[model samples]
Target: MFSGKLFLMFVATAMAQKDLSVDCGDDEWVTVRWRPELGFSQELDSSRALLGNCPPSRPASEDSLFFRVFLRDCGFIQQVTAGRVSYSNTLIYDPQPERAFISQPVQCVYDLSVGEEEPEETFSMEIMNPDFSGPAQSLRFRLGSSIPIRAVVEPRSRRPLRIYLESCEFATDANISRAAQVHPIIANAGCLMGSKAGNSSFLPRRRPDEMRLYLEAVWFAVGEQVFLHCVLEACAVQSLPVVRKACQFVPEHHRWVLLDDPSQSYACTCCDSSCLRTTDASVDGVSARKVLGPLVIVAEDPQGDASLDSQSSAGLSEAPVWLLVFAVVLVLMVCMSVLAVSYYLCFWRGGRLGYRPSRDLLTKY
Candidate 1:
């Protein structure tokens, strides 16, 4: 009986050593819970155990019953292969007395479904009417007219995500490159470069996952087909990062203004020069490329010239018929009088010449 009791105790010890549990079901984070054995609680140092070399986000909670850590805060290493994204880390714990370490590998796998059939399609960019009632069917626009553009991330994909326009350019083709004739509209991570000379701007956002850009219709060449290519990024952070901004150049003020937060216009001062990029890789974000258009900007109607031509034609028709006839007859009479005077002079000169010829003949005889 005594030997049996000792064997049961040994089995219980082995089970307690394997009590580490990791849950990767969370969308944004993985939860790690560690329960210490009955008497080893005081001997185990939770601080010594780490997730991917990152420490616990906070002290042990729930009356210290378990050590809880999040994958996002702990900086889990990410890997992508074969259209799959995986986050992985290991929890290692060492009890001071035993001098032996306990190891547990934790990982979370996410399938990348960028296929068109996927229901959780996240990102889209579209041109809308200025009022945003529906998609804009009129690709033809007039110069100085406002073109409303919107970029959106679906609500089902992720939460607490914000969208931003990283860079945008106008090109003649859908395939954009530096070698092509492209006009940079928005650059430096969302600064509206087109706003400097035009009235382009980023409209106030109505939602966190959506961004609206009001680009003024201006082009390098009139009647040329132009396409807008832009890079859209989604950030999971609650607030806008320093590098990500929606800046508009206010021609009236001669300064750049931040559309995300007008009070923090200081962040937009670099728009005139250059905006720095953020080196923080821990920020969860993804980018997508989008192209819109074959938009044509037409010149405004030449009403002034058209009206002048119409008036000149109408004036001639409006003149009295009798007055026109009288003018024509007057011109004809002037021509007839001049022709008769020339005829009489020619006849008299010929007669004089004949008389001089006869006088010469008589003198010779």
Candidate 2:
């Protein structure tokens, strides 16, 4: 009798626990994203799946993040046996760091269905140069500034890549002169000079990957125009030969900086305010605009701070009042000359037969 009673009790408990609708995954409990494309399909082939065919015991992925406590909530976790009705499952996975696999706790539920897969992936590479207003996509630096160069490769391809930043002046004449030196890769990778003032090569100090490579400061003289060009190239690796084919990038003339040696008199021609990077408080230097070609040094006048040359603003404030007067007088003289010519041509009486008296054409009264 005792054994029979125990069997009956077990059957009743399972019936009570069969209320799975209350235990379903929802936004309140777990992060949920409906994957419509994954409908009617088991995510893990009944073996690697997180739900159906799971082991009797659950192992924690990291720091014992698995759940053991049962709470009174909606939607019971149901193991899929078979059926298209159980389609449009929810997919949940921990977003991992670069080149890392998702933990085993990735969750999928039959809550949502997407007709299509996620949007097509896009690849991009960019140098976070200093942004100082306007369209020029430039980097502003002081003479002794060492900006940390970094690149972000999305969708985490295991392919190895390298970034190059070199002093490149991409003029048609320069391209012809250094045609042999120009690497078919970068606009002129082979022609990469150290700095405008001539210094060490701009190669990364160590083997650099996706991580930010903190380089030693290569000091350039103030007012030197540095046109830094960058190229993203994929390097072949023994482990991933196919990645080389999938990964292809091009050179971009991304950064143009006109370095400001604080000792130089005139403020930056393009930069409006002091520039700053994320960790620039400990580093010295302010933001400035990039000037192209030879640096124009403007001597500061004692009367005012201005550039010395035509490009500079030295003569703007120092303009004599007499010059304004002279300009007005010149404009008046031109206008008077135009008026005199118009009057003479319109009213002058030099006809083909000479001036005829008005009375000759007048009707007798």
Compare the candidates by lDDT and give the number of the best one. Answer: 1
Expressed as tens digits, the lDDT of each residue in 144-198 for candidate 2 is 3444345333334454433222112221112122111111211121122333233
The regions of model 1 sitting more than 4 angstroms off are 1-81, 84-121, 301-365
Q: Summarize candidate 1's per-residue lDDT along 1-365 as a digit string, tens digits.
A: 00010111111112234465555543444556665443534644557555543445466554232434433333344455565556555565544636555556566666554451222336898999768988997777777788899899874654477788877878777654211356778876778998897878887889878888788888555678888877677776455455567789887888888887877888888887756554354465655667888887667632445667877889877777999999999999999998777666567556332334468777898
Which ranges in model 2 have alpha carbons more than 4 Å from their true place?
A: 1-138, 155-192, 195-208, 211-227, 238-365
Q: Which pairs clash (backbone N, Cα, C closer than 3 Å) in model 1?
A: none
- Residue 329, candidate 1: Cα error in Å is 21
**Model 2 lDDT at residue 46:** 18
Worst 10 residues of 1 by lDDT: 1-10
Q: How does each model score on TM-score?
A: 0.50, 0.21
